[model samples]
Target: MKSRYILAALLATATVMPVASFAQQSAPAPAAANPASQIPAADKQAIQNFNLTDDVFNRIVKVSQEAKAQGIKPKDAKTDFSKIHSLDDLAKQVTDSDPRIAPLIKKYGFTPREFLLANLAVTNAAIASEAKGNPRMAAYVDQSKVNQKNVAFYEAHKGQINALMNEEPDPAAK
Candidate 1:
């Protein structure tokens, strides 16, 4: 009984003193030579497969929203968002005639819409930097069919793919 009491006291003291958490600091890291800043191979490919019609942009936006709801930590979601300037930029990019991305997507069997949704999840993290009236955000004129496709992709892949970039297990807790 005496040992139990001492153990409890020690545990209480440790809890009260606190310990450093592994959580990353809220501040953005300093700009430096880092690969995370560069768009990954997948992102670049999705850009070439993109068809920048309004429909596609709308779809990508919906995918981004769905990604957020699915516990996707934007900062860590897939590739970094800083690589994209705006929805238009992204749509145009995915639709670009990049020789690299188009062939890769063909090999992977990813539909253009699927590629676009993935692009949104990856890039939405960059919004913090672009939201300050970045001309890249663009004005919303209307929604389109591709928008619906994006939302659907988000619904289907939100857990599987969108979750990839955001999930970080609590190893210490284990």
Candidate 2:
């Protein structure tokens, strides 16, 4: 039960925190220097295969709400949030902003990195689900790349996910 709240917070923060930075972080110098490294290959596949489950998703939402209620806000990050390029980098940004988040998420069985991935997976699945029913939206999503499991989960919990995603942050919680 406590873990569920932590998980929810992790998911919410993971989605909101990383998104801006995910797009802007610099490319790995190591990858550039070692183009053939298995590390990069493994990281790529890990991101592609990060799985999401109902328990994990519930925890993320719970964590997010709990964090908000506690007023456990993240500080300003070091990097331009707009420039974060990878999940690792985004996790770093999130942790750096709020050291407390590490322990918070740990209670829910997530490393910050795992939270970010789960958050992204949920967001992607939501988008893909929406695209499935609307031809105009479907035109934008690549069906082959969408994870069927995630979509199925989203379909099953559309109302809850949408409510969480559309919720406005409480001003007093800031």
Candidate 3:
């Protein structure tokens, strides 16, 4: 029973793992030599353009964390959340593949891509917020600013974003 909750949390958080990986890789560069700047304008724009709300964002974070904790092994129960770096590690804790996530996605009436976009928006905001005080993370802070701008753009264009998300065909349906 506990495993089930952890599996769900991990699955929820998995959506942001890719972005987190990108941030980690680029976070160490000198602020002036930031690698995130090399990201194509179109790609950056796309991320900025995605929309999500604080209510949904908080829910995802809470649910994912709860789920991840539930899934932690008794031996590994002391593991820090930051130590679980990869999505695969989280996935492994639950089993071969997560069967629980699809239902949650369905419950939210979100296609996988929509869910991912929502996660990306929230994660970008989170990364930006975390980078605020640390000098070593200046590059990420810059990137986070861009991401926050994109989130704002998303909010401004929510109707169109929703239309596009709704139009996207669910991968499972195909």
lDDT top scorer? 2
Ranking by TM-score: 2, 3, 1
| Candidate 2, residue 162: lDDT | 61
Q: How do the predictions measure up, each by TM-score?
A: 0.23, 0.66, 0.43
| lDDT score for residue 128 of model 1 | 20
Instruction: Assess candidate 3 and give its lDDT.
Output: 0.45
Per-candidate total of colliding backbone pairs: 7, 20, 5
Q: Global lDDT of each model? A: 0.33, 0.60, 0.45
Could you tell me which residue pairs clash in candidate 1?
A: 47-93, 47-94, 48-94, 50-94, 50-95, 59-147, 78-165
Model 2 regions more than 4 Å off: 1-44, 73-85, 166-174
List the candidates ranked by lDDT, beginning with the highest.
2, 3, 1
Candidate 2, poorest ten consecutive residues by summed lDDT: 16-25
Q: Which stretches of candidate 1 lie over 4 Å from their true place?
A: 1-141, 169-174
- Model 2 RMSD, rounded to 1 decimal: 7.4
